[model samples]
Target: MKPRDLFVLVGIIGIVLMMVVPIPTVMLDVLLVINISLALMILLVAMNTTDALQFSIFPSMLLITTLFRLALNVSTTRNILSKGEAGHVVETFGSFVAGDNLVVGFVVFLILVIVQFIVITKGSERVAEVAARFTLDAMPGKQMSIDADLNAGMINEQQARERRKKIENEADFYGAMDGASKFVKGDAIAGIVILIINLIGGLIIGMLFLNKSAAESAALFSKLTIGDGLVSQIPALLISTAAGLIVTRATSEGNLASDITGQILAYPKLLYVVAATVFVLGTFTPIGPTATYPLAIVLVISARRMQTNLSRKQAEEEQMEEEQQIEEVRSPESVISLLQIDPIEFEFGYGLIPLADTQQGGDLLDRIILIRRQCALELGIVVPVIRIRDNIQLKPNEYVIKIKGNTVAGGELLLNHYLAMSPGFDDDSVTGIETTEPAFGLPALWIDEATKERAELASYTVVDPPSVVATHLTEIIKKHSYELLGRQETKALVDNVRESYPALVDELIPSILSIGDIQKVLAKLLREKISVRDMVTILETLADYGTYTKDPDILTEYVRQALSRQITLQYSDRGDSLKVITVGPSLEKKIAEAVQQTEQGSYLALDPSSSQIIYHRLNEQVSKAIQTGQQPVILTSPTIRMYLRQLLERTMQDIPVLSYSELEPSVEIQSMGVVNL
Candidate 1:
């Protein structure tokens, strides 16, 4: 039988037994007598409630059974009492336990018990459903947060599951404390004092003034007065000890059985004390075990209050920590910074394109090299390198990496932290993510499949394409003709479409989804027009993906700047010689003069001789270097200009596309120390 059922059964039988047997005059106003049974039933219900408070059919059945049992016992007792004459409840009722009356009353009790048990058995599922609904409906916010974490690759599927469980457990725990507190409220000391006084006075008064002649006195004497004539206090002691055990179990760490074990071991002394106390109460002196029960109830409720508060405090702290993590997504900059790239020599960008006619490498390597060449061409720089596969082979002007999404873990940072914390489960050495570049590992990962599944279940539909596309862009491009298109190409595409056709830009699917629809206007610049002005616009909008856009008018002002510039860098190879030069407006003769002096594997400067070329000031040195396939040199601070320079420099090296939007050209070098060339 369930502990709850046992509690109700014991309580009903004890109450009926009390009424049918006899009430000693002194114990007549025993208002607290019902407490014994009530306390146990609450504790039993509490045990179930404490373990799992989720919506479930069992709790409904359990609750219904408890209420049904109480109703039946109350009705039956009231009816049976009303049936008898004032004095003799069936002198037949007095001796009822031994006779046919006993058999009849007990059979009725058994039938009711069985009927209620069956109802509980049948209604169990509905009860569980109710509990589960209650648990889930109670924690929508926490559930949403868990879902978000799961979707964001902050936590895995299993961890999300465990987090939900923790939320449910906390809800149940505090809820039980509230219910238990209400059930046991009253003045504990007063009840204990009253029980002591009543037992002692009743025993002595019944023994001295009452005779065995009357039915009532005879009944009281038979039930309470032992053979030697002292009051029988065993029943009250049993109730007190049970109450203590139940309270200790609920309020302490030990399980019910453990509490019972401790009680049993301690009872050697308790038994003697109760036996002696029985005599004292019978002699009309008041003090003993019955008094202790009420006080135990008080202490247990108080302790329950304390535990609930502590758990709540812990839960709040955890919530704050989670909030901090979610906020950090402002940029993948942290991940990039941790990869150890120096801010001085290194630069990162977004939405930039590669120069098509630049250095030689496969389609992939070409993309990387072109970005650097573009950056170098735009800013005048002499550094381009690529870190792909596991080695850092030197690319004189370009390089590229082959990345497989399936093999890469999505929550690399989270995984790294987990490994740091747990010594037994630390196997994160296989991720070949790029950390050498300061901008490498820059939160550019796609939302994993695991994240999508979790978010879907939680009803957090994909709000942005990055919510679906960012994680697998690299993989998608590989399969779809989208090889990491040159940073400059991407920038140019955005510039051309956006400039050439704003509506066309709006209609064209974004080349990448990580930076979402919020960047719609910025993307259009690349589709319709290709120019320096459009390039700056693309750079300005790089890291805003996955976030809400707050400014619209400001974006338009920047697009015009990228399209107005008309400076171009040129390169060529003839026989045993390589030629490099810069050109703008009208400088064909200057380009020829510069081109004539260049040799294979050697560098030459392109001095723009025209007035318009000087006005443009596009990095002539960078143009020459990109054309000749040599490292470009740019004299710029660690700011937007520097970032632009770095973008082309690295593309010259071949890694991934870089853009003006990907980085800040801040002159502050505090966060980014110097880097060796």
Candidate 2:
């Protein structure tokens, strides 16, 4: 053990031994002084603490001090009864208090004991009990508040954990104080009982053993008993007061002294009223003017000085605030702060404020939270916090969604109307205003509440205004999710997977492929609307084929083939049949011949005339598939599948370009048409 710990252990052992050991007078006096000093220090420390938890160890300290005081009482009682003298400290206290009378000293000691036991200790015990009960009751609410803040992005994980720890510490501290207060009460009772025992026992020993007279024995013993009681009770009273201070302390920005002065003396004008009251009393009563007038004048003068200082302080504060504002405006960091952009921002006009205001019954914020969770589940990427704000530059009832500081999609809404989209047919009677469905570009109408039931009855899909915004926002986020997946976000995903598949992650990263290479592969997958939630499979595939090719497109194709079942289920319709437009052998051979290889990678280098003819043929087949109500999926051979996708990416970005290798054997393919050159 360290020296300090050993010292504490030896000190506790000594306190227990003090009851049995015969202490010398000089040593006893020093210990008595040390006890009083300790009590004073405790009281001072309690007063200076701004929060109860700052003095968390006080409960255990209270028990130790109480035990030590009891031990001191035993030793002093022994010396007084047997040797007729306790120590110089006790002798000084006896002479200083009683002088020539024993009754006064005894009466004073009883008063101290009564005050400590009944007043300070009793009140502290009750306060501690109430504080502990209230703290326990509030714990659940505090915990929930912390959770809400965490969910709202108001605090990070580390900050949330720290806040939760603080709450638990507060609960434990108050609970301990509740039990510690009882020790103070018991100590007070013990002091009184010990005093009575020493008095009676001293009287008997002084007469029988010292050959002192009855009166002499009573006088000597009474003085000694009262002195010992005073010495012990004084410290006990200080300690009890400290206990009261600790339990009653509320959280504050300053210590007890500053709070008292800052709050009680907050209004200096109150002193003027007191000054007037004192002057009136002095003038009306015959006993007063000479003594009261001087005090009243001093109070009035002090009040004036305080008022002047208060006014000057306010002026200085205002001036400092103005200066700080000016300095901030001139700072370079102010301009730099403006340049930073949010990853995703939802800006709306003033008229659409009700959609986001909670007090106005808008659930947009709550809806955004759900949208983020949905994106994470569907796309396997954490969506950044969407910044929502009102932009006066836009028309009222208009909203825009921006990705990385650029507006990508926008729409206008009628808050009091429902958007009704046609179900492959229109209802003439279920119309209010002409509009287009923002999410899917379908023809829709803004119908009022009166026409909502009519539209629903007419087989038209109906949704509220908030639903419209939510659908649009969710689609836009998913469309641009690839842009949000940078190195940092990829690192977070890798770290998360490392927790479960440490060996797999360790073997794959920085050896077979770096994070940038993995990010490129993942981005390609997201761009094609693929979910990377099956990370273990994705990582295993990368670890197997990553050594052969560092090209993201090639790796992506391999991952796609490995995830054939998932892709098959994603696009397959009823009866497990995939209806698609197939690429013919002539075009596939032409594209395969046009593939140009370099040190960097492969690219499609077909001539412009051939590309135009190919686009013309591809569009005709895609249109034919759409006319038949089948999604336009182009099925090509695995060798030129990625090259075909690269050719059609800019024009047919939304279309699924699948290869034969990316389909399951159980899935049957039904070709609608063939694209040929």
Candidate 3:
């Protein structure tokens, strides 16, 4: 242990020994002075702490100081009764402070005991009890708030853990304070008892053993008893006051002195009223102007100075804000900040500010939170925060969604109207303004509220302005989620999985496949609108086949086959049957033969003429499926599934290209159409 720790240990042992050992008068006097210094230091430290946790050791310290005081009382009582003299410090306190009046000395000592026991000690104990109870009761709510912030991505895991630890420490500190306050109350009562013992026992011993007269014995014992009582009770009073300060201290930005001055001086105009009141009392009351007039003049002058200072401070603050803004514009860091782009941005015209402003009753911000949560559940990736702002250049009703600084989608909305789409039939009576749905490009009309109910009754799908924006934003995020998952995001996902399945991650990462390779596979899956939420199954398949092949495209095909059940459930209607366009053998063979292989990877190198003819035929079948109100799912063999997907990716990015092996055997498949060449 360090020397300071050893010193504290030895000091506590010595304090306990003082009760039994016969201490000399000179040593006793020094000990008494040290006790007073310690009490003053404790009180000062307590006043300066901004938070209770800053002095968390105070409860234990209270018990130790109480024990030390009791030990000092024992030593002094023994000396006073045995030798009729305690020490120089005790004697000075008795003669100089009490002034040879026994009744006055006793009364003063009694008053100190009463003030400490009844006022400061009682209040400190009550405050500690209430604080402990409230802290324990608030623990669950504080924990839940932290969890909510973590889930919403407002704070990371480490910050949330730290906040939780602080709450636990606060609860424990208050609980300890609750028990330690009892020590102070008991110490007060013990001081009163020790006072009576010294007085009576000193008188008895002086008369019987020292052979002193009754009058002399009474005078000597009374002075010594009062001196000892005064010495002990003064430190106890300081300590009890410190305990009160600690238990009542609230968490603040400043220490006690600063908080008092800053808050009390917050309103300088109120000082004028106080100054006026002081002048009235001084001029009219019988207490005389000589005493109060000087204070009143000082108050008036101070109020004037404070008011001028307040005005100057406000002006300085405004000037500082302007200078900071100017500096920011001229700084090189400003240009660097502009170079960084948000992953997703939703910018609207000034007229649509109400949609994002909470004060205007818009739930768009809340809707975005739910959109991010829904995307996490559906796409299995944490979406970055979407930056929202108002753009002055756009039209009043226009808003746009940007991905990585490029505008991918935008639309116009009429705030006071609802967009109603026809159910394959036009409703001429329920129309207002014609438009196309931003998300799906369906023909719709912006209908007013008067026409909303009528349009609903007429079998039309009607949606308000905010819902339109929310749906459009959600679709854009889902479409561009693949672009957001880089190597860093992929590593985050891997770490999340490693927490639960360490061996699998340990075997696959950097051993069979690197993070970039896993990222490519995940991006491909997301590009095809597949949920990688089933990370366990995905990683298991990669670990099983990763050694044989390192190409992400081929590995993705293998993972697809492993996730057959999930894909089957995704495409099937009612979880029982699937209807799709089947690729003919002739077309499959033609595409398979045209695929070129090199050291890098494989790619389809079909001639321009053959590609055109294939595209024409595939489009015809897909149009027929869509016209028949059926989803255009193209089913092909496993060997050419990826090549065919690459072939159609540019023209038909939304169509899902599935392989025969990627479908479960239990699901029934019906061929709606076939593509042949």
Alpha-carbon local distance difference test for all models = 0.35, 0.93, 0.93
Q: Please say which candidate is ahead in TM-score: 1 or 3.
A: 3
Runs in model 2 lying further than 4 Å from the true structure:
1-42, 49-104, 107-212, 232-330, 358-361, 416-434, 444-463, 495-503
Model 2, 1-677: lDDT tens digits are 99999999999999999999999999999999999999999999999999988888999999999999999999999999889999989988988998898888988888999999999999999999999999999999999999999998999999999999999999999999999999999999899899889889988998999999989999898888888999999999999999999988889999999999889888889999999999998999986799889989999998899899999999999999999989988998779878899999999999999999999999999999999999999999999999999999999999999999999999999999999999887777886899999998988999899999999999999999999999999999988889999998998899899999999999999999999989999999999999888888899999999999989999999999998888998899843999999999999999999999999999999999999999999999988888877788989999999999999889889899999899988888999988887
Question: Which portions of model 3 show Cα errors greater than 4 Å?
Answer: 1-92, 95-101, 114-213, 239-254, 259-330, 334-340, 357-363, 366-384, 417-434, 443-464, 487-516, 572-579, 624-630, 666-677
Residues 1-677, candidate 3, lDDT per residue (tens digit)?
Answer: 99999999999999999999999999999999999999999999998999999999999999999999999999999888888889999999999768868889888988999999999999999999999999999999999999999998999999999999999999999999999999999999998888878777877888899998889998998898888888988998998999999889889999999998889987877877887887888888887788777887787788788889989999999999999989999988878888899999999998898898889988999999999999999999999999999999999999999999999999999999999999998877887899999998898999999999999999999999999999999999889899999998998999999999999999999899999999999999999999999999999999999999999999999999999998999999866899999999999999999989999999999999999999999999999999999999999999999999999999999999999999999889999989999
- The global Cα lDDT (0 to 1) of model 1 is 0.35
Q: Which pairs of residues collide in model 2?
A: none
The alpha-carbon root-mean-square deviation between model 1 and the true structure, to one decimal in Å, is 22.9
- Looking at candidate 3, the ten consecutive residues that score lowest on lDDT are 195-204
lDDT assessment of candidate 2:
0.93
Ten-residue region with minimum lDDT total, candidate 1: 225-234
Best by TM-score: 3
* Candidate 3 TM-score, C-alpha based: 0.72
Q: Is candidate 1 or candidate 2 better by lDDT?
A: 2
